[model samples]
Every structure is written in structure tokens, then in C-alpha cells.
Target: MKDFLAELIEIPGGSGYEEQAAELIAKEFSRLCDQVHTDSFYNVYGIKRGSVSLESGERPKVMLAAHMDEIALMVKDIDEKGFLRFTSIGGVDQRILLAQEVTVHGREKLYGIVSTVPPHLQDAGEAQKVIKMKDMCIDVGLPPDRVKKLVRVGDLITFRSPLATMQGSMVNGKSIDDRASVVMLAEVMRELDRLQYAAEVYCVATVQEEVGTRGAVISTYKVQPDIGIAIDVTHGETPDAPKEDTYAMDKGIAICKGPNMHPGLTEKLIETAREYGIEYQISVAPGPTGTDARSMQISRSGVPTILLELPLRYMHTTVETLNLDHIKSGARLLALFIASLKEGWQEWLKY
Candidate 1:
């Protein structure tokens, strides 16, 4: 999972530019699925046709969706001094903007950094102040003419946070928000290909979720599965963050609930975790979750959806941390869930 995540972070896929990431995911799913296809919106859906005959008239096809896009910045302008000014394409904490090394997408890799004023040059009243986007600029050490030729006004920029080994079970890198979720599905697809489960499994890798969960609308309209499960990353509150409201790493997957989640589906997930003795946590959302489940649920009438999140620290930042054990545990739990459905599926949903 550590190596898998690093490759995804290296790929420059922010919102509208998901082609590269989509290609890699599609190729992986194609190896496991009976049939793989992509919609006009670039949502990759890997289908495994039901191997068992359905007596429920129309068996609810299970659709597992994970967004492939991550939050990043877009180049707004270039100054005469060869510095690049950019703005956020998705949510970002301006507090952590200074001195961030980033990669600019172009024919070649262009390296730059978000600059901060020198301490000696700081004003007395402004010494302890937060800088806004307008005050920030990315310094790409290049001549003005050369920088103009490579970087344009509309290029994308992502944090150049490389994945590295941490503690025995931990992995730290950028974009762990949902990349781990996507990787989990990749492993699950391989298991599904081997198991040949009873339900029609749709492994969908969605795009543009960082912006507004756009791809799910198109993908769900096409697949229209009975049950939709969106796998994503959740805030793992640490010492600096409120523990009562957040989850922690190495505790396994956090199964979330609330208005966006299907009541019956949420119950089933917790029950499955307990029955198998898999480490799990309960998360609650009071409103529309910032996940693909929200989009999947409201698409084409309605669909029962549940959100499963992996605890990650420092979300949408330069470096996001996650536990590999949690990733494997999540994959195993979801795989067992699909297998358990064979004996009698809808009976569990009835309550």
C-alpha cells in the first residue's frame, strides 16, 4: 500500500485533469474485472457480473466508488521576476502555504515553491500574521523568459511531498485522502475476480470529487446500483486536533453515518466489523459529507449509500499520514462483506 500510494501522489491529477490517474486505475481494474468501461466523464467502472442467479427479481448491484482527484493549486499569473502566482482549486489551509515545494505540470517537470517574506524584512505589526493567497507567490528559480516558455497561466501545481517510510506500520505522503481508498478497491477487485461473488460488483474510480463530487453523478446515473459505498479518508484527530470529534490512525477503518448515510447500510457495516473482529470506529456527519456518497445517493431518484473512511491526519495538506494496517484491514472487511451477502442479501437491509 505504501508503494501504491507513492505512485498515485507522483501522478499529477487534480480535478479536471484526471486522465493520467484514470488510465493507471483503469488498467489495474481491467486486470481484475470481467468487463471494464469508462463513461464520457472519465469515471472508470469495473464490472464483475453476478455469478449466481438472483431470486430477488433485481439483485442490487454493489457499486464501490473512490474519487481519484486530489486538492491542488492552479497558476493564476506569472510576474516579471519569474515568480508564479496561483490560487487553490480545492480547499486548502492558507496557514501552511509558506515554503511549500510544488510541481508544475508541463511538458517537463517544473519545480517551484510558495515563498514567504524574510524575517528581517517583516513589519512590526505584521510579524505575527497569516498571509493570504494574494500575498503568496511560487518561486520557480528560472529566468523570466524560460519560465514563461514552460509554465503557462493555467498550469496545475501539486505539493511535491514524496512518500517515505515512517514507523513500522505508518506511511506518510501527500494525497492520502482518497488514494488509499482507491488502492483498497484495487486490492478488493483482485479478490472479487478470484471469489466470483454473487452480486454484480461495480468498482468505480470517480473524478472531480475534490471540487464538487461531479463524476459520481454521471457514473451512478449509468451504473445505477442498488447499494453505493464510497470509500474515502476522514480526519484523524491527534493531540493538536480534538480527539472527541476525530478518529486516530491504526484503529482500522472508520465507518461513518448521519443524514448522508443509509441507516440500514450503516448498521450492516458495523455489525460485519464486530462479527469478524476487525478493528473499526464509528463516525458521524451532521450534514452533507464531503465524499462521493452524497452525489451517489441523490443521483437518479435515490440510492442507499454508506461511507467507509480511512483515518488520515493533515487532510488536504502537503503531507497526509495513514497506517498501512488500516488499509489492509479495510480491504479485508469490505471483501468479507460482499461474501457474506450471498446467503441472503436484502434480509439484512430490511431492518
Candidate 2:
């Protein structure tokens, strides 16, 4: 898992430009699935056939969705001094940009450093104000003519935070937001390979989740599965954050219960955890969640949907962090839940 995650995050797959990452995900999905396909939106789908047959001549379909897009930047302008100005693709905090290393995916991959006025160079009260993204520029150490020759106004810029293993079972790096969940799908598929299941599984790595739930909306409509599960990251406990708003990393996986989540499916998830001795924490949301789960729930006349989250810290930033062990725990729980589905799967959807 560590080696695969390390290689996955290094590929730059910002929203609206996910072709490269889609190719990699498709390759991985091909290894575990009976058939693999990539959509026009760059959404990758891998289908695993069910072993059991029903009297209706159709097996239940389960769709698992996790997005692969990360918050990124795009070149909006170029200054006379050869420096580049950028705009964010997703929910990027402009405050975190100063002095950060990034790669400009122009004609070629150009290494650059996000820079702004130095504190010492700022006027008396100027240092007290937050630096807007417009004020910051990327320095690629190239002359104006050279930069113009290789770079365009709309080139994508991705942060250069390589994955790093921390003490114990934690790892921190860029794009862990949903990429971690993407990897968890692989873990689920790997576990499923060793078990017998009755429902066909469609593992989908969606695109452009950060921009909106666009990919989820399209993919869910296409799959039209009987059940949908969206895997994503939620806020992890931080010293300054309120306890109620953030979850603990040590709690294993977060099984969300809310209006957007089908009550029966959520309960089934909990029941599976208890029966299998899986560690889990319950999260409640009064309204729709800001995840692909929301879109999946309402797609195509309505599909029963559930959300599973992995606790993460410093979300939407390059230094996002999570516990590695939780991935294994979540995978086991999902595999068991899928294996538990029987001939009367429709009955499980009742309130």
C-alpha cells in the first residue's frame, strides 16, 4: 500500500486535467477487475462479476466511487520579470502558497517556487495584511522570453509535496484528500478477491470532485447501481478545532448517518462492523454532506447511498495527513459488508 500510494500521489491530476491519473487508475483497476473502461470524463470504471445468480436473471449491482482530483493552480498571467501569476482550481488557501515548491505543467514540467514580497521588504503596515494570490508569483528561474516560449497562460500547477512516511502508521503528503480513498478501493477489491460475493461490484475512480460533484453525477447515472458507497476524507482532530466537528484518527473509519445517507444502508454498515469486530465511529450530519455521496443519493430516480470517511488533517492542503492502519480496517469492513449481501438484498433497503 505504501509503495503504491507513493507512486500514485506523485502523478499530477488536478481537476479538469485528469487524463494521466485516469490512465494509471485504469491500469490498476484492470489488474483487479474482470473488465475495465474509461469514460469521456476521464472517470475509470472496473467491474467485478458476481459469482451468484438470482431467479430474476440479474445480480445486484454495487457502485463504489472515490474521486482522484486534487486542489491545483492554473497560470493566469505572466509578468514582465518572467514571474507567473496563478489562480486556484479548487478550495485552495492562498495563505499556504508562499514559499511552497510547485511544478508548472506547461509545455514541459517546470519546477517553480511560489513567492511574494519578503517580510523585510514590506512597508510598515503591509506586512500585517494577508497576501492575496494575485500578489504571489511563481519563480521558475527562467528569462521572460524563455518562460514565454515554454509556458502558457493556462498551464496547470501542482504542488510538489512528495509522500513521506511519518512515525508509526501515519503518512503525509499532497493529494491524500481523496487519493487515500481511491487506494482504499484497491484494498477492498484485493480483499474481495479472496472471498465469494453475490453482487457485481463497480469500482469507479471519479474525476473533478473538487470542482463540483460533476463526475459523481455522471457516473452514478451511468452505473445506476442498486447501492452506492462514496469513500472520502473528513476533518481529523486538531488541537484548535472543536471536538464535535473533527473526528479522531484512532477511531478507525467514520460511517456517516444523515439525511443524504439511506438509513437502512447506514444501519447495515454498522451491523456489519459490530458482527465482524471492526472499529468504527459514527458521524451525523443534519443536511447533505459535501461529498460524492450527496450526488449519488439523488441520481437517476434515487439510489440508496452511504458514505464512509477516513479522518484527515490539514485538508485541501499539500500536507494532509492520515493513519495507514485505518485503510486496512476500512477495507476489511467493506469486504465483509459486500460478502454479507444475500439473495434478499432488496429487503435490506427497508426502513
For model 2, the stretches where C-alpha displacement exceeds 4 angstroms are 125-127
Best by lDDT: 2
lDDT of 2 at 267: 93
Q: What is the C-alpha lDDT of each candidate?
A: 0.84, 0.91
For model 1, residues 1-351, the per-residue Cα lDDT tens digits are 566678887777888888888888888788877888877667888887767666765555899999898888999999998898899978988988899999988557788889988888988978678899877999888999898899899899888887876888887888777888989988777665556467888999999998899988888888888889999999887898987778977778999989999898788888888998999999989998989999998989788889999998888887788888887889888877776676567766664
lDDT of 2: 0.91
Q: Give the total clashing residue pairs for model 2.
A: 0
> Global lDDT for candidate 1?
0.84
Superposed model 1: Cα runs more than 4 Å off: 193-196, 347-351
